[model samples]
Structure formats: C-alpha cells, structure tokens
Target: MKWLLLSTLAVLLALAIAEGEVWEEDDHEVLIRSERGAKNQECRYAKGAWTECDSKTNQRSRMLTLKKGNATNCEPTKTMQKKCKKACRYEKGAWAECNPQGQMTRTDKIKAGSDSSCEQKREITKKCKTKMAKPTKGKKAARRNRN
Candidate 1:
C-alpha cells in the first residue's frame, strides 16, 4: 500500500512540473504554485563600458542593464563606481636666490597621499635679473692709474 501511494505522489509531481507549476516544501506542508509572474529566477544584467575617470572625484563608473527575459522584480538599471588610477601630486617649494647664470631654481616634492606612481622629486629653473652693487672709489682710482 505504501509503495502504491508513493508512486502516485511521484506521478503527480512529474505532471505538476510539466505543467509549469513549482512545488515548494515547508517544514509541515507542501505547496504547489504556477511559474507565471514568479520571482524565483535569478537576475541577469548586461554590463556597459566604463566611463572616463572624473578628476575631481578620482573615480570611474559604469552602467548595468537588466538583460532581456529577466524577472520583473529585478532592477532595470544600476550604476557602479570604482577608484581611478591617479597620478601623483607635488608640493612646490619657494624659489632660491638667483645664481651667477642669472637663473633661479625651485624644488618640488611629492605631497602626502599622492599616488605611488609619481616621481619623488622634481627641479624647476627659470631666468632672473641679478642686483648690481655700486663701484667703490678705490676701484675708480685703479682705473685712473691704468689709463
């Protein structure tokens, strides 16, 4: 008798599956429901190309769209973000006194929290005007003697 009952249940389950009906089992009960409008299937998304990095935010973003035939409960579109590979930042020092070549120079060092790819130090140089001192009286006498 038990064998006959089990075989009947198995046949019913097979028929339910073939008819687009799902069987859900709980601790104390078995439920049968139709697959139409059900949110049982996993969501699927089509990913879009990543956007250019934003310099101010140091981040990049991409769009995710739900693929065709996905469940209605799934979100249609979403956005995702990631940190961008950023260049290093530098802090410039004050310009030094002008040299004999009428040029001034300054140093730049990587600032705190700068990207690791940046160089540690940089040097900059530019032309400058040099100050002149007045000639002494002894220098004038020497010129007179030479003449």
Candidate 2:
C-alpha cells in the first residue's frame, strides 16, 4: 500500500513539473507561475530593499536580482515600482488678521520638489478670539441718572 501511494505521488509531481508549473516561496507570499512552452526555465529572484519614496512621482521602487534562472533568456535585474503615499510640503504665508467671523486664514503654497499630486495652493483657516465691544459712557450716565 505504501509503495503504491508513493508511486502515485511521484507520478503527480512529475505531471505537475511537465506542465511547466513553478512554485516559489518568498518572505511574504507563496506564488506559482505557469508557462506554456516546450522548454521552461524557473527563475528565482532576490528582492532588494525598497527605495525612498519619490517626491515628483509619489512612487517607491525596488530592484529584483535574478538568483537562479536561465541567464541567457531572463533579465538579471528588474525594477518594480508601486504607488506610495507622500506627505505634502508647502511654503506657508503668515496668517492674515482675524476677520469679523473670528476666523484667521493663511495661504499655503506647494513647495518645490514636492509631490506632483499636492495642490498648488491651499487656504487654511483657524478660529481666533473675536474683539469685544466696549460699553458706551453715555449709556452708563443715563442709567445712573434714571437710578
């Protein structure tokens, strides 16, 4: 029984290989690749550290070096890019005087070398203390006279 089972498993493995199926395990995932060709080469790559986010494009990239593959047919190194969230930088102007609504506003201009997706100009508003009106002396004098 054991011999039969082993032989069946071997046959299945052979069939899977013959169909150009490749299984690979990485740090974060297990992937499979299939190719339809008489001669298929399984390539393995070593992923390098990701590069810093690019301000202009808002993208991060990494390099993949081929570790095991048919060098003649496969590229030795490849670059992969992915979209990234970048913090917007701006040159802020001084806050303007508070308006009658008790709100102060400032202008923020996109800084040079900032991400392209950042807005060209932004208006920021904040609450401020509203000026209080002083009591009129005439009203106080009339109240005293009435008393």
Candidate 3:
C-alpha cells in the first residue's frame, strides 16, 4: 500500500512539472504573424513566454504557443492594459448641444483633455418649475386654501 501511494505521488509530481511547460528541448519555431503549431507540435512567437504545443489550439502570437483545440493566449502586461485604456477612437474634446427649451447638457470626458473649452461664459435664463408632492393634510391645507 505504501509503495502504491508513493508511485501515485511521483506520477502526480511528474505530470505537474510537464503540464504547460515550455522546455528547452521543444524545437519551437518562429512563424510569420504568430501562426499556431499543430497538435503535439511546438510553435512560438518571436518574443514572449508560454507554450501550449502539446495541447489543442490554433491561435498564435509572437513567442506564444497554441494547443490542440483552443487558440493561444498570453498573459497581459502593462502595455496591453494601457492600449485598452486608450482604445476609444474619439478625440479628446468637449461638445455641447442646447435645446430650444434652454435645456443644456455639457460634454463628458472622452479622454483626459488639458485645455478643453467646454465651459460657457454666459448665464442661462431658463427657470425650472417645481410642484409640491403632498399638500398639507389638515391645518396646513386650510391655511394654503386661504392663501
């Protein structure tokens, strides 16, 4: 029983070491435009880490590998995060549209602009009307009616 347990432990350890590991012996090839390797084959990008050559995948990137079925993926770095933050195509500026009823809405942030002129100098003349929700019940209602 002890021997069987030992054998099982050893096998698990070996499998853990072998999984998702890009070894020096793997003949990783640099392809044009991140092409994925075939099943059990190793392909890689010109730069970066991670190799899923033994698995199933077709997605490829520079210095990355694809497995037998799924596409290749790489761990995102700071650069990727920055790219995502600035991905929006709109330019950094403010735009305002005022309706005929004097309802004005200011432009929100598209990107962080330093010297945006979204502010207006003239004061608006529109006044909004407010209605009371609940009128006074007894004495206040009598007073309001007299007023």
Candidate 4:
C-alpha cells in the first residue's frame, strides 16, 4: 500500500538523522609524548580540533579527535615529523610509533644502551681533547715572544 511505503521511508529518514547526530558527538583521545621514560601526558578530545599540552619539562603531549568516519592517522608537523622519527626507544628490538608531527606516542621510549653510547662518546671526546691540547700548546709557545 502507498501508506505502508511512506511510513517505511519516514522511519528510515529519522534513523539516518539520529545516526548523524550521534556521530557528531563521538570523540576519541590519544596521548603523544616526545620520548619514552617521560611522563604519560594526557590529551582530551571533545570538539573538532587537536590540542597539544606541555605539563612536564622536556616532555610534549597532544590530544586529537576527528569526525566518526575520518581517519585517525595523526600526522606530525614538519619539524615535529623529523624530530619524532629520530630514534626514541627501541622496544623488543623494534621502534615505537610516533605521531605524524614526530611527537612520540604513548609507546616510544629511549632505546636501551642509548645512555651508554652517550657516556662512551663523552669519554672518548675527553681523551681526544687532552691529547690534542698537549700538542697545540707546544706550537703556540714556540710562536710566543721569547725571553
């Protein structure tokens, strides 16, 4: 009957409108950090934009929320992208994920042995400095005014 078809169409239209309204309210939260061992910063999503907050020194955090159907692929900004790709921590022998802007996700941390490499490099540089300084002084003294 014509009335039956009309009723069904109306129901479908109402359902579609309801679904759309719900989706507008849907929001997701994700936390981004600059490095591992840093505090787990918190980011909140409710409206449409991503907001980044720095609550701790030397740590960066961000929050993102997009439309229900939009992709959640958080991309880092240009400077952030390079900085994020920089090695953070190697976990289980694999690098952790970072935001598109290079800000670290909840998972990235300083790779093991990273600290040791810094220490070793410092020691080597110190030794090289001592050796280089000794030879440079002899040449400088020769050029100085003689008594």
> What would the TM-scores of all predictions be?
0.34, 0.38, 0.18, 0.15
Residue-pair clashes per candidate, as listed?
0, 0, 11, 12
Model 2 lDDT per residue over 42-127, tens place: 55677888898877897999887877678786567766576786768999889999988889999999889987778999999999
Candidate 1 has a TM-score of: 0.34
lDDT of 1 by residue, 44-143 (tens): 4566778988878989997766664345555577665767876778899999999889899999999998876678998999999656776666777998
How many angstroms is residue 111 displaced in model 1 relative to the true structure, after the best TM-score fit?
0.8
- The best-first sequence of candidates by lDDT reads 2, 1, 3, 4
Query: What is the per-residue lDDT of model 4 for residues 10-70, given as tens digits with 9 covering 90 to 100?
Result: 7654663554311111234333322322343222233433233233443433333432221
What ranking of all candidate models by TM-score puts the best one first? Answer: 2, 1, 3, 4
Sequence-dependent TM-score of model 3: 0.18
**lDDT for 18 (candidate 2):** 83
Better of 2 and 4 by TM-score: 2
Better of 1 and 2 by TM-score: 2
Per-candidate local distance difference test: 0.70, 0.73, 0.38, 0.34
Model 3 RMSD to the real structure?
18.0
Give candidates' CA RMSD values in order: 26.3, 17.5, 18.0, 24.3
lDDT, candidate 3, equals 0.38
Give stretches of model 2 more than 4 Å off: 1-83, 130-147
